[model samples]
Target chain A: MAGRKFFGHAEPREIVAFLTGGIFGSGLLVSGMIDTKKVQGWLDFFGAWDPTLAFVLGGAVLPMLFVWRIAEKRKVSVLGTPIPPRPAPKMDPALIAGSLMFGAGWGLAGLCPGPALASFAIGGWGGALFFLSMVSGMIVAPTVAGWLSSRTTS
Target chain B: MIPQDWIWGALGGLMIGGAAAIYLLVNGRIMGASGILGGLVDGTGRDSMVERLAFLFGTLAVPPLLVPLYHSVDTHITTNPGIIIAAGLLVGVGTRLANGCTSGHGVCGISRLAPRGLGSTALYLLGGAVTVFVFRHVLGVI
Candidate 1:
């Protein structure tokens, strides 16, 4: 794997990245984020309305709120690399259009990128089908987004 | 009353937040899943491709190993082929177009009080609810 050539071994950065991802994956599983029914039920707010997801959201957000502040105080990461500064929020057409598209899709399928990946074991071949299609969408999104950007700007 | 799901959900949520916090503090990057994957797939993240790949590897490889700890795991993804493809493509395009997903915009972006994150998350959640309503109530196809 090309990753092995990164500094000829696993650097702390790579290790942390791996750990971060692992922790995330574990969290997704334990938190039921990977459960399609749970997700769909949450989205079914107008229906039976499972309140499970809000807790997950709250759990993730509350801690992250503080993390961001701490990060803001540091010029560089512990690794001594500059943190990518947050971009100013802009509400644009592409965002609006894309958000609608994403939500519609999310509601239809009850899967998103992160859980889509994590749930492969549980979701099986059907999951693979969704993932491949998602990759296709992602590949083409830039061109579509670019078109949206141009239209909005001009 | 909080359901059992809530306890696990919050615990899991905390872990997710902790992961994001670690990534930001150590690697100095926001932990947006779609952005990470999109960057790699769309050829935008070539410089840090190794890191991206490693992070992705964790996301892809780790969860399956942990499933044995659970009593049972079910994703309940729709078996409908058409819905599967359309939803996948939409998520792919939507996240990329919007530059984030739940993790990016919902967790990371909202936490930082970034407008892009908040706005996108709101819209996507709305998107989900509206779609569910249409699919379940109106069209009855989803």
Candidate 2:
């Protein structure tokens, strides 16, 4: 099959991102990261003291390190988009607020976007709740962003 | 440590990875799950609001269709609905505020070697760890 070109410039970065995410998700799956029960067990903090979750993350980190190394060597990404200097957000209130909220949600639902997406594919109640809540969060963001933007503009 | 669970996890990863790749190829966008999700919410990039919603829903719901192959994985989310709702809102807000999520930063951001992405992912991971500690260990939420 002839490969048709898409995206103004298809670059290796895009390929890497796609593979990395898929691999991460696969890693989560193989490691039982998508299972909210296992996730919850890890989150339990008080009960069985399951720490297997960390290993899944640790395993992914190895491959991730390799991918980033390759990415850094190339000046222009396959997309032809010269990766701009990484912008660092000051460790500010917004970061704190967002992180807290995200952690709380994960602790509560035992799912985040990645694992939620994976679990949703496999039919689980936690995934369903996660999908719904995730939307709710998005719906509410614009008003907040607009308000914040206005403050910055003023 | 059931062997089958590991098999399912691996399958889930491949499906998600393939999906991200396809999206990148088609849209020329990173398959940052949060970004795609945030876009679906904001309705600014690529698709219109309705289309975005449909696309987002499809992206999310499509995974469950694989249940037959993986066998249904049982779950027990012990938290109340209110906590779940609140947590979701926070994540959405955080994704937009942070300009990404785990997929966006951990996967796409790192792939691009964006310093911001790396920083953001680190924040996310740290946040996740701390939150879990507080909720279960301190607050004692079962």
Candidate 3:
């Protein structure tokens, strides 16, 4: 049953996934994060700085703070799946370096993972190009990460 | 009146987190967008490919449908293929190496106040600010 496809299930696993995805989808659309210029404006602290993203971050975090508490106390989810409590997150070189790398990319184009996907609805060459390139980049990431890990360890 | 951008953004933010909460409570999975895509594409989550693909499909499908409501989903990304490719590659590589992104680390991790999540989020925020200063302010090239 756990191995069942999303739609294939009689249970609500896939339906929940779809509904959440819709929330995330419309959230981006509503928030105007799909607007690359606005995203850039949020990053443009030195220029005409737009503080909308700060609010977005703050608003997004508020609910999740409560969600984490509820999640932490739960043994199983409402859908009857195991809810694993997260441990103390470890600080490592990869975390430092990778975060910086991702930030640079995000600032460069003002497109993060969620916005990029949401923007796919626009049906533009720019969106298609970026999405494909990002996917291709993800495909090779493990190899790059593996090499980085080996190099750092050695 | 409060700026529409902030109002809409906050409302959307609440929705985003609300959706994530649903995913957490109902699906028992962290609602990190990059991790979902990265896991599936990278084959690390091949076993859950069904679920991941379904999530991807839903998110991707729902946005276009909202066009009737929101009118347009303009992303305003740069047309320069060079910039697009470079940015895409960097995002992919960086997120995978660090193991999270804005949704994962920024929203999910920071909300929980986890060390790695907090640390990564700080570093990326700094990285983004510095990059914007150098590229947008200094070079004037996006």
Candidate 4:
């Protein structure tokens, strides 16, 4: 079973990823991170503010710091695939602008992609609208960026 | 009763990090939601479709199962159709352009101390704060 493959590839890793996703979703649900009201409450600084999200961010980051360190020392992941390279460390305009836009969106809806999709089971029509529009935006992002680039250049 | 705010938040964060750690260590992939989903739809990540789908399947499947068990699964998402659509499109375009989102850049990227991740996180946080400020305070919209 150690070297066995499913569909000509390692199926166990896929299973692992699937299970990991389940854990991730359950974590979101259990932590109440999937709630738009909580998200908005955290962002509403000048109003009735909730500092809990800050703690959530902090909590999530602490362990991953160690994981990254361990990952760096190994060329291949535990499952035998090449580890992904560190992304180029630059503060380019695209990164800044894109993040800014996403943040605004997050602030507006109290939803990011993770919780948006995770909340779908209960989010109902509202979730469907957001999910559909989001996919549409993803599909058109390349073209929009291209258009913006051309306009700037010309 | 549900757990305290900070307690559950931190614990959840740990689970999120653990999931990400598992993904990285075992699959050698970053578990950013947008990047994973984007790759599947945008044709750039076709090579890893099976893995991505597996990951997504797990992500989407678990929450509903846990809904009854957890008293805190409430999302309270906005009911306004316009805002939802707008927010969704902005998130879609912005995250794709920026190359990551909360899970990817905010959580995974910042943890690794990557400049891109840090920069993106800061800008988004700033963006979120300002938007909230303007909308909630200035315009009185929420």
Highest TM-score, which number? 1
Off by over 4 Å in 3: A1-11
Q: What lDDT score goes with residue A98 in model 3? A: 89
Q: State in Å the error of residue B46, model 3.
A: 1.7
- Candidate 4, B13-36: lDDT as tens digits: 888989999999988989899999
Cα lDDT for residue A130, candidate 1: 92
Q: What is the TM-score of chain B alone in each candidate?
A: 0.97, 0.78, 0.95, 0.95
lDDT of each: 0.89, 0.57, 0.84, 0.85
Which stretches in model 2 have alpha-carbon errors above 4 Å? A1-28, A43-48, A75-85, A88-92, A121-126, A146-154, B1-29, B47-66, B69-72, B108-122
Best by DockQ: 1
lDDT of 1 by residue, A1-154 (tens): 6845754787788889988998998899999988877888899878889988999999999998998888898878999988778786678888889888998888889898989887876788889999999899999998998888788787
- The candidate, 1 or 2, that scores higher on DockQ is 1
Please provide TM-scores, in order, for all candidate models, with all chains considered together.
0.96, 0.67, 0.95, 0.93
iRMS values for every prediction: 1.0, 5.4, 1.5, 1.9
For candidate 2, what's the RMSD? 6.2
Alpha carbon lDDT at A76, candidate 2: 45
Tens-digit lDDT track for model 4 on A1-154?
A: 3224323575888789789889888777767788888888888878899887877888889999999999989978998998889876776556767899999999988889888777888888888898898999899989877876676656
